[model samples]
Target: MKIKLYCRRALMTLLFICALYTTISSISNITLADMKVWAERVQQETNHPSENSLKKSNLEQKTMNEQTYRPKTLEEAIDFDQYETATVLATGYTAGIESTGKTSEHPQYGITFSGVKVKRDLYSTIAADPDIFPIGTILFIPNYGYGVVADIGSAIKGNSIDLYYDTVDDVYSQWGKQELDVYIVEYGDGTLTEEALKALNEAEALQVFRQQYIEQ
Candidate 1:
């Protein structure tokens, strides 16, 4: 009787150990399967796309970049004569030398003109003729470097453009009066119309004497 009882107890202990091991193994397998499913779902979401959204975004960016820097039409690409004004290129010289009689020690060595100023009136021209040239234009001059259309000018009234020189010497040295082609860079205000430009030309550009100087 004693031996039979001892044998029964040993049998029950072995069964309990097997049950625990089976439960642990089943739990581990379940956890691994769940992890794999989650990883697959994440990858699928990342790979999927709605439509041509990416392509459309890329195209829009390209257009904007080209419009910002490149001139599309022939009118956008124009050439004009440049007039030189000053001999030296320096900032704030006028203010510095206004009080002091001394002019040479101010840093820049160049002749200053009293009455004339020149500029390229890009906005006005674009406003006058959008068909010819659009706003937000960029221009490139080979020898003159690059300039943006910041504002309009009275002399730069038509398809004409005005170039600025640092000095009279530079203007003469570089042949300021000669014609040069200008590439339309970006866009700005507008282009000048033919009619407006003609009117500007007909008007008196300069006045030498006021009026009625009859030997008084």
Candidate 2:
């Protein structure tokens, strides 16, 4: 009777161990399968970008470019509603040592601050305080027609301008220091790009600029 009882207990113990081993093996197999699936999903995303993500990236780049874009021309740059009439203290100057403190032998003799050669007479070159009128600003003087602000003077501050003349005699005889009525036709884009400056350095570029933007 004792031997039969011992065999029954041993059989029950063996069955319990077998059941635990089966449960552990099943859990291990399920965990390995889940890991394999997760790794494959990560690799797929790494290898190929989604169409929606690509479109989003492109849209972001376009928005950034639009925000940074600047107008390159007077027509595109200026706001006509901002135009106003102004009274200015006007002086006269020629490309001479007395006016510019530079001789013809100097490399920057005829060159204005905007990198353009000075043109004489009506609708010609003028100097002003760059703080008020930046390079490429167009002003219409009652007697002078139209003059572009392309230079700056040490003494020209606030509402003041130094009109350019062909000769020193013209400066003395025609225009001296006086008050003038001037119109602010259009404001400049307030930029001096190296490419634009280099192009303006050409002899005929001033004529082209005048015809395109000023003569009208």
Candidate 3:
């Protein structure tokens, strides 16, 4: 009977050991699964780039572009869109604007209503021979600010250009076929500065003018 009791106790001890083993195995499995999930989360965080990081990268690229910005080249600017070869331009302006016929028709632009589709603004517009200064040509006059080759005239032939005036008296009083310095801003594959681009963009007419100039 003692021996039988001892065997029964041994069997009970074996069952308890098995139960302990099962509990330990379950705990080990749960811990391993948790470790796997944690490792995967870590990997994802390491591999994926954050939204802020991407934005920062883009900002850096933009900064680099700004730091390296440059205007247009004269070598490229001198080549006319239509002309096979670029011609040397005369340095001075020799012409005058008279409000006659279509010139006095209606103002194209500016505060005052002076007739022609082009304006009377100094930097905004100018009249030139289509043969010499084609429409949409950007010019830089020394005393004058910036002007475009917007209109053509019979009297505006050759290198002579007609500056716009409010009245015929203003035309004769201001400039009566006098010589003034004139410069072409750009021609052919010219580039505009950021400020210049902003200015051009603000004006719809200038944008169209630039497009026509570029396409040519």
Which numbered prediction scores highest in lDDT against the true structure?
Answer: 2
Alpha-carbon runs more than 4 Å astray in model 1? 1-136, 189-216
Model 2: residues with Cα > 4 Å off, grouped in runs: 1-83, 192-216
Alpha-carbon lDDT, every model: 0.40, 0.73, 0.51
State the lDDT at 52 in candidate 1.
72
Candidates' TM-scores?
A: 0.27, 0.51, 0.36
Lowest-lDDT window of 10 residues in candidate 1? 207-216
RMSD of each: 17.6, 17.5, 14.2
lDDT of 3 by residue, 1-216 (tens): 999999999999999998886798687765557768989977976799678777998999999997786333322333333433222322222222324443323453321121224343424456666666666566654333355655555556677765555455644454556565456655412222334434553565433234322321
Tell me how far the alpha carbon of residue 13 in candidate 2 is from the true structure, in angstroms, after superposition: 99
Better of 1 and 3 by lDDT: 3
Judged by TM-score relative to the true structure, which candidate is superior, 2 or 3? 2
- Candidate 1 per-residue C-alpha lDDT over 1-216 given as tens digits, one digit per residue, 9 for 90 to 100: 999999999999999987876787687755556768979877875697335766777889999998798543323443323322212111111112331232555443222121112222221121112233333344544444433332333333445544444334544565345454555545445543344433432335211111211110
The model with the greater lDDT, 2 or 3, is 2
